[model samples]
Structure formats: structure tokens, C-alpha cells
Target: MWVRDDVCGLGPYQADLVETYWRWEQDPASLIGYGRQQPESLEARTEGIAHQLRGDNIRFTVYHLTDGTPEPVGVTTLLPDPSVRTAEYVVMLAPEARGMGLGTAATRLTLDYAFHITNLRMVWLKVLAPNKPAVRAYERAGFRTAGTLRQAGYWLGQVCDELLMDTLSSDFSPPSVISPLMP
Candidate 1:
């Protein structure tokens, strides 16, 4: 696991955690932040989880540590475009886990893993503009605005812009750690 000062860690994804992810994906509150137009049924959600588990993406279950016990609080994924050595970063914080900065911490940890372990060139993400908290979190994690898709999303019944942000492998201080998971 990638530990972060007892606040959160990125643990290997496990099948048993599918239900937790499904719950977060279906939570209305989470949907708003995720900018998901609709919630998935159990069948669809499970199928999607299967895809992740099958190695179609690099995923991790985010866990919050309570006195050393890790409780899952979110998930992060990097949907890779291997040909270009780039990927789209996606993260979802459980409804009860928002506003605590776990998402930002997780993003930073994942960025380190992406560039150091996974050997990716760049990582990018699209977030609803109305989701200020998420935007701020991504920025805090070393991402910079790449561009914006004006009114490209619908949030809370209003059309919202989608902000594009990205970070290159060279954007951060030189990496000091490396792992076996290379692309």
C-alpha cells in the first residue's frame, strides 16, 4: 500500500470491495461530484467493476486509517492510452468521506505511482466546473489547467463547464521511488 501519514492509503483493488464501489457510484451525492448523468444498475456496475479487475485499467481502493485499521473511503483509476503513454485520472470519494482531503492525498500518491512505477508520460482529468472542491483538490495534487470545455456538463440542473487539467511526469520533483509495475 502507498501510505500517507495515517490519513489514507492506496491498496490493491479487491473483488470483495466491489459492493463498496457500487455504493459510492450510486450515491446521489457522489454522482454530483462525479458528474455522472445517471446511476448504474447493479448489473451494469458489477460489469464495469469486472472490467477494472480484468486489468483494463489501473485501479486502487482508497482507504482511511483509523487507529491503524484501514477502512475504504474511495477509489482512483488511471484509464491508460498505452500508445501515447498517457492516462485519464479518475477519482471518487465516498459520500461520507468528502471534504476531508483524502481525494487530494490519494491523487498525489497515485501520481507518484503513475510516473514512477507505471512509467506514464502524462495524466489528465475532466471535472465539472461546479465541483469546486474536486477542482481544488486536483490542483493541489500538482495538476495544472490544460483547457476548459465550456458548458460541457450538466450539474444540479444547470449546464456547467468541464475543466481539463493535466500533469506531466516532469512537472513534479524528480521521483525517488520505483516499482515493478511498468507499462
Candidate 2:
């Protein structure tokens, strides 16, 4: 399966999976880790959804596993704009994979792509305040709490604050450090 920095050569089956991803993100609450859901069409299935997917100055790329199943486990991407050399980022792991540490691994891989490939100065993501697990993961991943946007989101009938966490290209340490220490 495709499991690298590029999404430029997805075959038909992989492309179909990417389309299904857009459909699944329709629920606002369901998109806690992904930000807001956007409208999509069968005709709009391009290799990269960055130009179409919107949330401030962010964008995303569909990521696949190395297995032959070709199933997509999550989406990841870079956010590049004139005001910041950093790329805004986001990721949403499948529910069943939540505690498996896959999200953190996927995040670190993406960061490596952003910095080494995209040559970004920094990479950042916004997480809802209540998502303690994610916040902790970001912390463990070498991202510091850069700032917070109070009541930045209105999800689940309540105003939710957002934590803007970031890691500089120079600050990101490899997840391999933890892998050796884990059982």
C-alpha cells in the first residue's frame, strides 16, 4: 500500500477510499480531531484535498497503511501560508485504533514529511481543550502549547476552547525515542 510522503499516484481503489473519507467527515461532532466537515462530490476526488478542505489556513492528505488492503487509517497534511513558514496540520485516527499509539506515529511521520520534504519552518495543530488525550499526545510528540483560542469552536451545543500546539522543525524529536522505551 502507499505509505509515504506523496499522495500523487493513488490508483482507483485508493482514490475511492479517499472519497469515502470526505463522506464520513460530514458529522461535525464526529470530526473532533479533523475540524469541520466540508461538502464533496464524486467528481471532486483529486489526489490532494488541501485546496478544497478548509479551516483557517489548513489542508490535508489521505494516508494509507503499508498493508495490501489499501484501507486508509487517517488523513494528514501541511498548511502553508504567507504569514507563517509553518504548516498547519491535522489528523484523525479510526476509533478502533485510538489507544494503539498509531496516531502519534502517524503524526511524527507527517511531521518528518513536513519538515524534511516540505521544508517547513514549523508544524502546528489545533485541539479542543477537552481532548486531554490528544493534548497529552501532542506534548509527548514535542509540540508545546503555543497559545489558546478561547471559545474558538462551537461544537456539541457548547463553546469549546482550542489549544494551538506547535513543534518547530528544529524542535521535533523522533518517536523512535519512545518506541525503544515502550514494552
Candidate 3:
């Protein structure tokens, strides 16, 4: 397990966690942030998980460590572009896990792994322009807006711009510990 201060990396896809991912993929509410409205079938979800496990991507099931037992909150992935020593980063959290600081922690942890473990010089991600919270979280984790792809995604029943954000290995600084008194 890759341990950060408040989150740990678990599996590529363990047997017990497959159903959790399947349910997340099928729920419309969950799909909103994922930029998809079509629900995937259980078989498709299974196959997708299998494919990801076999692919070159580094994937992790993020678990929050605030509680005594690790509570699964989301997943983070780094899809490599070996030719350029870069990777595209992606993260998704369960609905119940939102509004907590878990997303930021998970992102930081994954970025650390990408830069340190994989020796990747750059990590980038695309976020729908309307996802303010996510944009802020990514910013808090050291990503800066690189550019925007106009009308590149259909989200919330309309074409939306996608903001490209990235952080170079040299630009990243580990997030500071959150004070308990702060929100």
C-alpha cells in the first residue's frame, strides 16, 4: 500500500471492490463528474476494470485514513505517455466522499507516486469548466491551468469547455498539513 498522510493506495481492482466500482459507473449522479450520462452495463464495467488492470496505467483505490479503518473514497490513475515521460492524471470520488479533504489528499498522493516512483516529469488532467470544486482541489494540489479546450465535452446537457491543468515535477510541493480548526 502506498501511504500518504491521510490516504492509502489499495488495489488495481480487488474482487470485493468490483461491485462498488460497477455501482458507481452505473449511477447517473456519479457519472456527472465523469462527463458521461450513459450508464455502463455490469459486464462492461467488469471488462473495463480488467482492461485497466492489464494496461500500463498506474491505478489506485484511495482510502481515507482519518478513521481507524481505511474507508474507500475513490480512485486515482496515472496513464503514462512513455515517449514524453508524462502522464494524464484522473481522479473520481464516491458521492458520499465529497466535501471532505480526501480528494486533495488523494490527488497529492497520486501525484507524488507519479513523479517520484514513475520518474514522470509532468502530470496533467482535464476538468469540465463548471466543476469549480474539482478545479480548486486540483489547484490546491499544485496543478495550474495550462489551457482550455472549447466545447470539447458534453456535460450537464450542454457542450462545455474542458480546462487542461498540469504540474511539472519541479513545481510540485507536498501539500501542507491541514489544521483541525480550518475547514
Candidate 4:
């Protein structure tokens, strides 16, 4: 069954769809990576992400384009801290799936799930400092800068900071977009 959120549609993953999703991730030239080399095998990447999904530490969901196909256009993972009342989120969308407002919609929907469906007080995430588009999207969706971790990520060659951002449960609503902003 497909689950509808205000921003995007999601569904439980099926093993058969792994290959298609795998190829999307394998393409390092995609928006998520900078034309870097990818894992040698799609199977390897699929298994790794699947393992994460099954593990106790994370909750995983797959997203499709607004058209509602079974083919996934994105993936989201929510990793709870040891306390389980707080968690961090990571979302990645295919290059073609972005910039059409899907990211913002999907994120707002995720925030609702994080805050209402779960017992979370805070939902946080870290984005690479250079990813300005993502930063802007997070801000528009109600996430505020919590802090930054300097030299936290060493990608390509030089070190980079990760901008830590957060949204509180009290700051979110089911009608997420139209809700009044909290002070």
C-alpha cells in the first residue's frame, strides 16, 4: 500500500525494486555525488542500505515521484539516538527528482512523521556546508541552525563542516505547511 504525506508519497520497500533503486544511487554523477566512483556492485549498495533498514538504529522509508509509481525517486532514513526520543534524518533524491519542490514537500512530511508518529522531541540533521540549496530548503521547512561541526566530514580531499540543524516537535503540525510558525 502507498502512504501519502502532504509533500510526497512513500511505501514499504520491495526486494524486487532494489536493482532500480541501486542504479540510481550508483550513479555518482547524480546530484548526491560529484562524479565520483561508485560501489563496484549495485547488490552491495542495496544490501548495505537494506541492512540499515532492518537494524535497530534506523527507520527507513522510500519515496516516489508525485505521480505515484512504484519506482522510488528518493530515500529517507531516520536514526534515533540512544534516548530514542531524538533522531537525525538524511534524505537523498535523484537528480531528476529535485528542484521541482519535492524535497521541501518530502521533508515537511518527514518532519510530521518524526514529531507526531514517533515520540520524538527533536529531529535534527547535518548537511554539508557547501550544499546551500539544501540549507535553504531546510530553513523554509522550519529547521533552524542548531550548530555546526567543523571539519566533520572529509570528502574528496579537504575537510568540510557539517551544518547541524533541528526542528522541535512543538514547532510542527499535521497540516505542516499551512501551520502557524512558532516563536
Candidate 5:
């Protein structure tokens, strides 16, 4: 387990956790803030995880450390661009884990890993504008609003804007004392 603050980095994709991830993707409530709206089959989900594991992406399951056991809560990923020095960040937390500040902690930890361990020069993400809590969380993690793609997504029977945000290694200020777990 890779420890970081209150969470730990868990896997490349294990057979036992595939169903749990599929459940998260199928839940309509969880689809509100995400880009993909379609429900995926079990096989498709398994294939997607396998592809990610074999691709130029670094993914981890976020687990909240509770009492001595790590409870799985979410997932985070860094997809490297062709440039090789930059990447896009994506994170999703289980509904039960939201509002506990885990998102921010996990994001910070991920960013630290990206910049410090992987030596990425920049990281970016596009979030649905209506995801206010997530925008705030990203801002707290040092991401600046770069721009917006107007009416870029369809959700809840309406069009929504997508906010593009990014952060550079020069601008990131990692926690001085946190020891990030290296995979």
C-alpha cells in the first residue's frame, strides 16, 4: 500500500474490485458530475481497467486508512500526453466518501506523485462546471481555471459547460512533511 495522508494507493486493478467499480459507474447519481453517462457491461469495465493498466496511465485506488485497515474509497489517474511531460488528471470518489475532504487530500497526493515522482511539468483536467464542490477542491489543490468549453456536455437533459483547469509544477506547492508512497 502506498500511504499518503489519510489515504493509500492500492492497485493496478484487481479482480475482486471490478464489480465495485462497475457499480459506481452504473449509478445514475454518480454519473452527474462525470463525463460518461452510459452504463458499461462487466466485461467492458474489466477491459477498460486492463487497458489502463497496460497504457501510459498511472492509476491507483484510493483507500482511506481506518484503524489499521485501508478502506477503498475512490480512484485517481494521470494520463500522460504524447508530449510525455504533461498529463491529464482524473479522480472519482464513492458517494459515501464525499464531503469528508478525502477528494482534496487524494488530489494533493496524486499531484505530488505526478510532479515529484513522475516529474511531470504540468497537469490538467476538465470538469463539468456545475460540479462546484469539485471545482473548489481542484482550486484548493493549486489548479487555476484556464478556460471553459461552452455547452460542451449534455447532462440531465440539458447542456452544461466544461471548465478547463490546470497547474504547473512551478506553481504547485506540495506539503512539506507528507511522505508520498512510491509505486
Candidate 6:
């Protein structure tokens, strides 16, 4: 496991967790900014997971309660843009985990990993403007709007604006009370 704290925990991804990720993608709320309203089949998703294993992507499973045994709640990933030393951040939660602060907590954990462990300079994400709650969560995790692409996202047959937000290594607010390692 990466970091197991009170709010949430993250563990390195394994093949056994493929089904859990496939299920999370099936949630409509999870597809809001992902372009497709419907999720890909398990096989297709598994191929992507396999790629994550082989590529520079850093993927993890978010756990709900981590004291006794951490229960899986969601998936968060950092897809690196190697040339730029930046990454695209993405997170999805189970339906039951929505509305709670899990997404935000998970995001902070992932950011901590991105800035502290991965040595990345920046972590960014694109969100459909309609997903106010998600945008808020990203902001709470220290992301700031870099720009907006007008009508750049399509959802349920309607085109919506997209917000490009990012948090740099300097923006660090460690997931836990103690700060991550630095020189």
C-alpha cells in the first residue's frame, strides 16, 4: 500500500483490482468529463490497465476505511506526459462514495504521490464545467484554473465548456499532517 491514513489510503494497482475499476467507470457520474457516456467493456478497460502496468502511468486503488482493512472505494491515476514532466490526474469514485469527501481526500493523496514520490513538476486535469462538485474537489486539493476551452466537452448530446486546472509541485499541501520528503 502507498499511504494508509485516516481519510483514505492508496495501494499499487494489481490485476485483481481490474474489475473494481471497470465497475467504477460504469457509473454515469464517473463519465461526466470522459467524453463517452457509456463505459468500455471489461476487456477494453483491462487492456488500458495492462498498459498502465507497462507504461509510466502511476495508478492506485483508493481505500475507504484503512485502519482494520482498507476497503476499496475508487481509482486515481497520474498519466505522465514525460516530455513535459507533467501528468494528467484522474479520479473516479463508486456511486456510494459520491457526495462525501473521499474524492478530495483521494486527490490529495494522489497529489502527494505525484509531487513527492514521482518528482513531477505539475499535475493537471480537465473537467466539464457542469461538474461543479468535482471542480470544487479539485480546487480544494489545490488545483487552480489555467484556462477554459469553450464548448470543448460533449455530454448527453450537449456541448459544454471545459476547465483546465492544474497544481504544481510548489502547490503542495500534503495529504497528511506531516509533509512529504524534500531536500
RMSD to truth, every model: 3.0, 6.7, 5.0, 4.6, 2.6, 2.2
Cand. 1 TM to true fold = 0.90
User: What would the per-residue lDDT of candidate 1 be over residues 1-183, giving only the tens digit for each residue?
Assistant: 764445778888888878888898899978877777777888887787777787879998898886577888989999999999999999998889988889888888888889887899999999988888888999988999999999898899999899999999999654333343443
Candidate lDDT scores, in order, read: 0.85, 0.60, 0.79, 0.68, 0.80, 0.84
Question: How do the residues 1-183 of candidate 2 rate in per-residue lDDT, one tens digit apiece?
Answer: 223432211122234465556555544444655455465565564635444443343334334444544445555556576466777776665554466565666677667656665678988888988887788877766788989999887555577889999899889665332234336
Q: What is candidate 5's local distance difference test score? A: 0.80
List the candidates ranked by lDDT, beginning with the highest: 1, 6, 5, 3, 4, 2
Which residues of candidate 3, in runs, are more than 4 Å off?
7-12, 175-183
Quality of model 4 by C-alpha lDDT: 0.68
TM-score of each: 0.90, 0.68, 0.89, 0.78, 0.89, 0.89
Better TM-score candidate (3, 6): 6
Pull out the clashing pairs in model 3. Answer: none
Tens digit of per-residue lDDT, candidate 5, span 70-166: 8788888898885769999998888888887888878887888787878899999999988889999899888999999999986687899999999
Better candidate by TM-score, 4 or 6: 6
Task: Please list all clashing residue pairs in model 1, or write none if there are none.
Answer: none
Clashes of 2: 0
Best by lDDT: 1
